[model samples]
Target: MNQLRDPCRSAGRTERGRTRARNEDAFLDCPQHGCWAVADGMGGHRAGDVASQWVISSLAALPRQSNFDQRLKAVRHCLRILDSRLGRALPLNASAPYAIMGSTVVALLLEGNRAACIWAGDSRCYLWRGQRLYQLSRDHSLQQQLMDTQRLTRQQAQSHPAARSLTRALGGRQPLMLEVLELCTRPGDVFLLCSDGLYQGLGLDALGRALSRGAPGQVVDRLFTEVLRGPAADDLTAVVVQP
Candidate 1:
């Protein structure tokens, strides 16, 4: 197997339009090993910001390892530990109001010339090679479930009332079903991990065009502007990694 290679990376974040109380999104930068991540918190009645912060901090603090499998295992272990901590800290009480507190995570790890990515919830990871764009993560949202049952079209799901309702997330009652992807790396490849807030306004075509035409910073700035045009429903976070 080919090894992963280090890549230059950049990241950015913003809060949504309507919600002023909290910005519940997080991201990390690990340039030394070409690792980057973006996490979006479940926003409602609970402290979603806290959940996002804990998950991001745990992933960022993972010890560096030489082996790919070891590194991946460490990442998974860290997430599990965070889940347990959150469960202990914020137990749900049926007698009380809804206490939903969890986060969506998407991360990219580069080793030698190969790359692996893991994701949970709706936060997304995408790969851009040449002119083609590939989405690496699957959403754990209710709209996705509807699509699976042929009850909603992709376009309808985008604006569904329950679009934000996630089926899985870190800190939830059940263990998160993490999605992982492995890909070959090349020098000009660009990987993006971002919250739904960033992509809800702009489609893949617009994102791909922006990435192809500008630097990472410029792309993020433009994307933020586009998202701000819509109702600010949640926090927005993005991480752009290029190799």
Candidate 2:
């Protein structure tokens, strides 16, 4: 059996982008805790930024444990607290279209050779190796639901007007149904945790190319540069990790 390697170089950045009045994206890069995450808030100005910040803070406070199961439990605890906290801060009104204060969170927890991905809403995690990039987490969004039901192809769903609408999130009306996936790792493997905004304008191929361009720090810089050249549809955030 192969042994697991610790996370090496890592870099992350969050930008308000060209259009947004305020950035609602937040991230964590705590290698010592073996946790990294990205959160993108939604529901306009009700409390998007606050929700996103809580997502990051909650995960960051989780006890550092090597056991995957315990770590998962810790993550769950934070999410519930986030729900309760934000739920109270932003009262939900049935009549309002965007009433709940919530955010999408995607997290990567690494222990030994294994990686556990946890997520809610549409924020995502991706792996890059051998010049190919693989999206590790699936979006919990209307677009994804349409694809799952075979009502729309992946490409079609991406372009659909409702693509940005999330089907699930931390403080939404529905109980949070977080998703998790565990995977083995390699030495050269690179992982990315990002908000949907970072990917909205970036083509998948371009993203892969940027990941392959250089070291972790270089790759992060390159990704932002690429996004800057294009029209930013939302606030952008990218967290790059290597192990």
Candidate 3:
């Protein structure tokens, strides 16, 4: 079976914290299939949870294969499938439109020592290697747009009201603007995929410190502690991938 030859192995864990009314985040770790992902959903209603589940399940259903191109193609295909379903599930002018029901997806597919990443919206993917952290994906959010046009300062954008407002996401009417990243993976390298809730409260410097000090699990716990020290406003989720 293809699964037996899978070169990647991973562990995924999640927690529902003290504040949010619902857990609208999802994650997956299928090391045998070389897939790992984190999705953060938006919507006041149950639509957020629904959107997140759809993304995770769709990605999980993709075939396990050795070819990188084929694996990436499957990832895009899964996203399209989610997009179509979301469109049918949430019409534009419905009485209770699920328009707000969208999600940011960050995923990595590892084959041997090479990794491919795909992202939509603001949920981020960071690569930590040799004590340096590199943000592998750009946020597709309103704050990012403002920054691009020089309309908002970086510090201001961090606290901007629309910082959480995503410009692109899965299940929206517009086509997804997916970013693909390819990088070499090392034995001691770490990859962090997390929701805005994790980043909003913990600055990059703090995050770097945590990553430098502990294992993947410990880093996640420290991050959660930092987040809880601040005002709790949204659901938080984090997935650390290390090999």
Best by TM-score: 2
Go through the candidates in order and give each one's C-alpha lDDT.
Answer: 0.77, 0.83, 0.78
Better of 1 and 3 by lDDT: 3
Tell me each candidate's TM-score.
Answer: 0.89, 0.91, 0.88
Query: Residue 91 error for model 1, in Å?
Result: 2.7
Model 2 regions lying over 4 Å from their true place:
1-7, 43-45, 93-98
- Order the candidates by TM-score, highest first — what do you get? 2, 1, 3
Model 3 scores a TM of 0.88
> Would you give me the overall lDDT of model 1?
0.77
Cα lDDT of candidate 3 equals: 0.78
Ranking by lDDT: 2, 3, 1
Kindly list the per-residue Cα lDDT of model 2 for residues 162-242, writing each as its tens digit. Answer: 786888888886777888898898877899998877887688998898887577789888989988888876899999998
- Residue 60, candidate 3: alpha-carbon lDDT: 89
- Candidate 1 lDDT by residue in tens digits, 83-151: 667766766577854565678888888876768898878899888888888888888888998888777
